[model samples]
Target: MTETSPASALLEVTDLAVGFRTMDGQVQAVRNAGFSLGAGQTLAIVGESGSGKSTTAMAVIGLLPGNGKVTAGSIRFDGQELVGLAESKMRAIRGRSIGLVPQDPMSNLNPVTKIGTQVAETLLVHGMATSKDVDRKVVEVLTAAGLPDAAERAKQYPHEFSGGMRQRALIAIGLACRPRLLIADEPTSALDVTVQRTILDQIGRMTDELGTSVLLITHDLGLAAERAAELVVMHRGEVVETGPARQLLEDPQHPYTQSLVRAAPSVAAVRLSPGAFAAPASQRLHLAETEPGSGGAGPGGSAVAVATAAGPDGVPPEPAEQNYAKTPNIVELKDLSKVYRIRGKAGDFHAVRNVSLEIPRGRTVAIVGESGSGKTTTARMLLKLITPTSGSITFDGVDVASLEKKALRSFRQRVQPIFQDPYSSLDPMFTIERILEEPLKTYKRGDRAERAARVRELMEQVALPASMLRRYPAELSGGQRQRVAIARALALNPELIVCDEPVSALDVLVQAQILKLLGDLQRDLGLSYLFISHDLAVVRLISDYVCVMKDGELVEAATSEEVFQNPRHPYTRKLLASIPGNELNIDGELAS
Candidate 1:
């Protein structure tokens, strides 16, 4: 563990313990966790959900929920004891001395108020500015946080701003008073890579100018290693390891820390294969005509196809004249577009424009871009959820727009969707058994006994226990819930699955499990996928081919290896450069 002298430490936490009062009883959240940050230094606490990292940060900022409190330990800020500080005195220090940038900007910022009013409130409360000059100060703060046209933007409400713009507004409020310390909790978890990098860069510049220390809370190991100087690994309510960022991540001693490093796709030198984890050999799938030396070895010492290589002339080699190229196309989008006409807006808004792509049999093709880039719009059109303003969609040699009621019913049964939020995707009122059995009953596939047997088989396929069938969705963890979602998608044994940001909401370990499961299923059953996501690292891990989208246009489309190693488009290159920890070399290979 890295140590900081008390004299030089800006925030020192020792033997800290926190608990929340629940209806059943008092539940401990953080226990015996300790770390110290020197003045102007940055520290990060990283762990999965319910790991107490965020709880620790809340305790330090004296903003724990009404039911939560610090049960034991010491909190000293600049040599002043804060553990037992009075509420009035703590309020005085909360925003003026210690600032906060919360995780979800939409939930944290008031929806009804204008952006300028929210920012001005912070300055006025801290006595940073007077009424006559408060609006100017708000513009200056927003400008410093990298918001363009700050004066004009300040007149808008939170809902009117984009995700990145809202986050910048939060930062402007947090640093309006130039606090001595700042606490940022998963500030960019929901943002695209390029925007995440821009936000972090702005934070670095502002903090350096003000000489402010930072306490960052996040679940992304690559992000933590890139932004912070020191690392603190948190497990179930305890500190497992702490050290210098690069040293700790490269040579993690704790088993938990090592698992995190292995699960992180951003830092892995090679793509994770089915054999990389503990899966039965009978479950592994192999592709035909896989070239020699084109794949990576898994933990079981078996080669798995990861990426297709280019030829000697920097062009992708043509497929050999074989049955592999003869495989039929599963889904095709030809010049598809969607234009929404607003009630007041004069011009029509094109969400997706002239997007054409093909999903081959038993292969994964991914659509990747930032928010409002029309990736989701494309997926929705392919699903037949929305009618395209122009162009055509063909499914298995039949045009989708020509399908009637019965034909559409058959089409829905042949194709399935795995949505992003597991919590909302599954019905909370239904048991796991019922959730899995509903589709079987809908199709009249078999009797009650047969449906029961199929439900059990699905649970086994997703690696969930049959005992969980009796439980509700609320009883399962995030990973378990996602496994249930995947099982539901496979219930009908569809030929193609549309996974929309399936693993983006999950942590590294759980995300690895989901990706491995998807790969295994694709191999076991000749399933095709139309995957949509904003994470290029995840796209690298799971996709066979990649389509880069921007402002509703297809910027670049190529094999996964070609897109990452030889990006031809400027936007594609920018996205690659934005991935955190891309500069670090791990195990003799670049992290990106």
Candidate 2:
């Protein structure tokens, strides 16, 4: 096992500052930041959106963008100065000694390349093995990641794997030759709770077994608490505080850390000291359990039920027929399904199967499922993004499919969709001012002066700086960009916003801010939402109703309180079991 060398640190970054030249002005993207890592150690840098955590990591890897440059800093890796290392020299050590597992493996991986070939390239490039050894090494590394049918899966491309599996495949590539350090950024943000545990557990176990120092950069404090030994808090391009994970989280010396830890809304209270709140085993389990029948509990009170398909004449039907509800329904569907046709070879694939559900307005609904399970598809149909293959979506006493092109625009204006990656949603060429004004312009909501004034009002509404009006999307942090996205969604004063994993990309504290922002908005505006996400903890906090989806089918839809407390569907039970908490314990379906 690799051990920390007292002679010198494995990776040391000192006095780092990064800046970028923008049309408006020179923005200080990253301020003075410093940290170090040793073998078998895990350090997590936590902060809200716009903090310099990601910038620091990129500087260390020499991956800074074109306009951004390190003003002052030094990076020493294993006694070798890396600040000015040649690309060729750095490339040799990048994966061999300092590996990187990116934020979105789906985007990072080559879509057309086979998984085994991708795994073997790392070894071949580093000169660790020959072409003949690729197949065996691929199987070995993939199996180590707990992937089933390793040999067969190895031959598939990245598109063939689920979000969690793709994450493991990337980890397998990172660990192919066992680098001294591994950088994983928001590794599990995109996966469901059940699959989330498997990925986190695998990464933790591998990092421990290989003695590879891990730098886990993320916004989720719970994830850090689960895997990291040490924590560093950064804000506005500076290191605010640093200490052991338990110490910094429990009794955080910095106000920022305290605010972040409090933001989760998980009802977890943090005490300021080591081993602060030690609950008995029974208490832990009880806290995980919430008030029962959580229907219509989200944002407004989410709606959930495990009712199956209904037969003709309002009679109770098969599992694939209908999901009945005792109360009046806000949103109802019958046999909703979506299918996508492959370009040339394999025919069509059922992206979402027959789904039937009923959700009350002013209630939050969570659709849970693995990747490609049609969670997003359901959200899209609700938003009228694409015409459903064969189903009806009735909203506010009107059939959505009945609308024409001109009418669809009006529907889009009312039912806005907030995406997962806030940065991509906004245009890079436009300033925040222009970005917000375009929608108002398209809809002709207000005059120029009214639009400009509304833009400033929106910035403050989402808790952003007034100075951010002229700034571009790239200038803002992930959290800030999300706030901007929210502002855009509200430009028309939308009634029901289709939030598609809006908070998944942000840090825990920023997540709290966004949730509070949404909740406050709903209370004040009386807005309804169809929230689609995989984070159960966040779902519990914001949703009143829950809808669980699988293989394109609605497995369970019920109140958040009921679904979390007394889940009837087997899939719902599995999802609750996967959350990263000690309170509620449900055994995973995977055989022990």
Candidate 3:
């Protein structure tokens, strides 16, 4: 490795190794990881979960959990070695010199504390300001972080803030001290595209203005490519590739990097082959040949097959044509609106507004928007969890609003839900078999032996080992938990599935698996989906038609292709543009 001068680099990590002492044994988390961030420069470490990206960052900041420790390597900051630093000394440098914007705002921020108090506490602890100037400083930082009504917002508790607002508050605290270096770990991974862009842009402006170096750790290759000057790709605890961001992405020298580029839904121009992320070579080749213009030869050895496919065959069919092609709508919403009247608030809060949509048989209609866009509220209304103030919802020409208790229960069996956080969604006390069988038993789908057999069948359908049926939720990985959730949703063989941010919590590779599973199941079982998500990229991969929501209203609606390729609404266009790594072409070529 070439030596980087101390004067030029703000933080330099060399041959870093980290490990966790589990009950089984010492598990190495990071092995031989190295990177350098120059003053005022941005460096990003990109990888899937357990690739040691976050572990490396935490080691650099001396914030590893109890079981974790830096087993080897050197972390040098501003010519000072951090590996052997005393806890007292490390604490002094932590917030004062190196700040952090953690991944989850809800977990990072104290629920009991006011936003202003939280910001002020950081400043006071670091001795950055006196009590007299702390309030003013807090307001200034909050405003700088792009929070509206900074002073009033600061007084509100964390629960009062929206997801975006809470993130802004976290940013305010991170930048309040104007630290020389900032470590942002998956900061916008959970956010909607527009809000993510806003927060990241704000961070960029603040860091640039303050001349602070940034170390960004994320699973989003596009985000890293767009935001960072340098990129380090990690896999299985090792740095497999590191170089200039654009060059590395455009022409990755490593196999893992290549797979990541191909698997990332944001970079894919079309819906992927089922299990394409993990497909065998022959399978990939078959899919490529079958897909028009995937280097498939046509008459006269011309690529004309590709060009022809781009027209009538490839373009999204017109709505009228679509209605003609598919079966009659399985579910329909007409002039749907939901309003909540707050006791003290002057005006009623409109949670959903005159939104009209349709879910045709065996099709997926995705609702895309930022948090608070009424996507969940709209789904809840459809599920009859809450009553809609006006308009109507119909399933097979029967009004769902008028369904009685028994009929409603029957309707629920036909339309099931899969929640966002799989860990929380599944009952921890139950084994996987019991979890899957409970839904079957509750609906009286079968007797004891039949239900047990059905549980085994469900496990097979989700591609999980039957042996895992005896395991509890806590014993399984995030992906496995989600598979269990999928099995439970499929227990009744629901025709319509309401999937709400189903894969958001899993790692990228696991996310690909779950998405492929969903796509495959849809094809085989003829399932209809009302999918809701903030990730436009994932939406691109899964949905047939897309509804773009903003401020509880539908701002744009079209086929996925139309919405992605030629969005008429400015908000839709902005959301598309804001997708991380959307700037990077799939082949690592320059953006169009």
Candidate 4:
């Protein structure tokens, strides 16, 4: 990578270290991490879940909670050491000299407040402008970030905006003061593929136009390779490799990087035949095995790799890259709808309208929508988590909503639900070993010894260590806890798993790893997943079929490529257009 412009270097992180003191052990989340970004430059810190990318970003902003501490480091923003600065003093620098685009908008944004007020508050805090001026600046920032009708939008609360727009609002606040440096931690993790692309591209362009430097923390190597000029690869809180993005992706120096690229799954070999979606999961898993030159890590952390010995799709190949590695009918909905009645003085509310669709087995179908858009409600109906108000919810030809308690529990074994937050899904009081084994015990599938063995196998399947089994959920990072959650979901060996925004909380790199794992599992075990997420980009990468929802209604559903390349639904199109990555114009918005 070229040198950060000596005079233009806006933020420099030198010899940074971060750790967490817990009862079980002291986890070194980051150690001796260093990087520099000049005006208009974007630097991406890429790594798997435990690599400490998020920890480093948190340290830069003095935001580590609990027992986590910045053991040693210098976060130099415009040559000012921010590590030891007082809260009030540091507060001045933040949003003015340095800004933050938080990972989770839900947590970062106040639910009850208007979006405009939040953005205005930032300006007010820095005393950059008067109330009137803050309002005008808020509108300008929102417009630049590509939100629709900035004036009207600013008045709406966080709950009103779509997932993509909410992200843009966060950026607006971060850039409200035109800070010299922007720290974005997994900014695109929860967005759809199209949205993910748009968000990054927008950031890329905005940084250039504003001459703002950026420190991007993500796990998505593909994204890092595409957007970042320089790449820093970390593993276990240590920097193992740092270099140009293209070089690292094309010819990674570290074994971990190399293995990650190999283990990733691709969309090129998606079932093209009439019976493609109907093929046994085993056959689909082995579909591309015999045809490839060299085998990489197979899906779901399973060791099996199969190929057909065919050429590369009879087309000139781009390159052998991307490490690692969905459907229509099993979960079908006809006139599916959900509504809730207000018990107080108010009346009934229609949360979900009439929706209809057929989900094929062995294919992934994503239900994307804003919060309260009936996406979660739909998932509940499918998994029988919550009975639909008035719709025929069929799973494997059975009307699940009509089932009794015992039968419903039995049906749950066939279709399990994976939650969005790793923090809440796991029982903090329960050991990881116990957490994983609970599902198996609930089902009484086998002997205690056999169940214990299954837990171990599952731990290996999710790429988690057996030793982690002794630890509690609080003892693990966001990614590890999520992995354990997946293992728990897999214990029943269900025919279908309802994954609800599973990777939204993880860093991009860890998100990719989880996506790769899900793909691997589908191939190895031929498991059918009913994946639900707001992230269209991940949906694009992993799903066979796409289902877009808005306000509890179906917007669109089609193949991955078809939907991404040409989205007919206006809402879906808006989501695609708002992605930050696609908004990137490498003309040096900052350099100019």
TM-score of each: 0.84, 0.79, 0.87, 0.74
What are the C-alpha RMSDs, in order, of all predicted structures? 7.0, 8.6, 8.2, 9.6
| Candidate with more favorable, higher lDDT: 2 or 3 | 3
Better of 3 and 4 by TM-score: 3
Clashes of each: 0, 43, 2, 61
TM-score of 4: 0.74
lDDT tens digits, residue span 195-304, model 2 = 66876787677678887888888887767766788888998889999887766666777777767766654522211111112222211110011124442322222223
- In Å, residue 309's CA in model 2 sits off its true spot by 21
lDDT of 2: 0.72
Error of 4 at 469 (Å): 3.3
Kindly report the root-mean-square deviation of model 2 from the true structure over all alpha carbons. Answer: 8.6
Best by lDDT: 1
Which model scores highest in TM-score? 3
TM-score of 2: 0.79
Per-residue lDDT tens digits for candidate 4, residues 253-326, read 78987765553323222332122322222222211211122211111111112222222365422234211122
lDDT of 1 by residue, 224-256 (tens): 888999999999999999999988887789999
How many residue pairs of model 1 clash at the backbone? 0
Q: State how far residue 238 of model 4 sits from its true place (Å).
A: 3.4
Q: Which regions of candidate 1 are displaced past 4 Å?
A: 22-25, 105-177, 267-310, 313-325, 342-346, 428-430, 441-448, 583-592
